[model samples]
Target: MGDYEIALGASTFIKQAIDLRPDVGIVCGSGLGDIVDLVEDKQVLKYTDIPGFPVCTVSGHGGCFVFGRMGGKNVCVMKGRFHPYEGYSYREVARPIRVMKLLGVKTLIVTNVAGGVDLSFKIGDIMIIEDHVDFASMVGRNPLMGPNDERFGIRFPSMTGAYDKELRAVAHQCADEMGLGDVVRDGVYFYLAGPVYETPATSRILRGLGCGTVSMSTTAEVITARHLGLRVLGLSLVVDLAPVGQADDAVGPTHEEVLSVANSRSLVVAKLIEAVLRRITV
Candidate 1:
């Protein structure tokens, strides 16, 4: 079966189980899955239960979909998001986004925990993704690389505005209002294909490339969301500092450390998301 068929089948199965049509879709990454707890009157469906769905193998992901209301709008929250590092193709990693599009999601909010590649960044800071350096896509691993599915989108979709401008403006305003103006920043997200963290040398290279935040996920999903014409808003939390020029034996990031930071600061991210959702026209 093709990707479009798989997405359609999943959406069909989900629609049969829930009467609500989502206006917004949220893909929670890594330890950020707790954001779904904000969903009111939620109906959850495990990935294992959904047809053509890929299960999450990572530790931080919840592996379920939560459908409910938030900010006075019906929404679908992906409690777990797939990654290329998990042995999935770029297309498979982004399939849920297509499913969300089929389920009537007009807007997509994606969040991930990333290492801070820029020297100015500190752990626990939130970076509003103004743009991204899709390293994987640059080498031809884009989610839209396969045969065209015109039913879902144009054969040649433009990505200049992949991150919605209006949504980002509102996110900034919301952060300021929440007294987090100093904590929140806007920068470029560098998408690396990784199950392993970057080495000190690679981190230096990323810094040279002007990457503000770096991670393994988000780009493929954002590309898919943009292809399907969904307005996208990306939020990245800096959980660890990239080891730029540190000594070879210097301590580096661990999955456990990333989870620890993500778990601790997730509420702040949740609050910012709630504020953004409430304030946006949606």
Candidate 2:
């Protein structure tokens, strides 16, 4: 089936569960599922139940979508998200974003747990994504690499300032209000095709390339969101620091460890999101 048709099918299925049209959408990352607890009057729908949505396979990843409210604003939260490392293509990973757009979502607030690539970052720090280097897509593995779907977007959607600057500023202002200024930082993030953690040398290389954080997801969905005319903002929780300068004996990150750290900071992530939602205009 065509991608547009697939996204329309999923959006139709979600509409069956709740009529609350969300202006803002959130894709919860890793063990950040606990943030769903902050959503009020939520209607939970499993990914499998949706006609074309991809089910998450990784452990600690929830396989559902939630329609709820925070700051009295309608919001749709994907309690979990698909990833390439889980055997899905980039298209599958980006489908939920398309579906959310079709469902009337105009803004996207994406969150994920990433390994710190920039030594300046500390574990539990939340990095605001000012830019991204889609290493996988840069090699032409992009999800948007296909026949043009004028219904979704033009064949060439400019990637300049793909992440909304105004929304990002609002995010930092919220963090400052919450006394998290020191813990919240801004930087460029890079994507890698991974189930494997980055090697210490790789971390150093990525840092040299100007990446503050690294992950296996987010960039694909952000591309899709921006292509569809949705304003986007990304937040990454640093679960662990990459061994950029540590000795050979230093430990590295693992999926289990990332999820554990995500659990410990779910509330902090949710508070920031809620604050952004409350202040975002249109």
**lDDT scores in order:** 0.90, 0.89
Encode model 2's per-residue lDDT on 1-282: one tens digit a residue. 999999998888788777799889999998998878889998888899888777788887888988989867899999889888888888999999999999999999999899999888999999999999987877878789889799999888888999899999999999999999999999998887888888888888898899999988899999898789999999999999987555576788777888889999999999899999899876
TM-score of each: 0.98, 0.97
167-257: candidate 1 lDDT, tens digit per residue = 9999999999999999899899998888888888888888888889999899999989888999999999999998865666656899999
Give the poorly placed runs of model 1, Cα more than 4 Å off: 246-249
Clashes of 1: 0
Candidate 1 TM-score versus the reference: 0.98
Candidate 1 lDDT at 122 equals 88
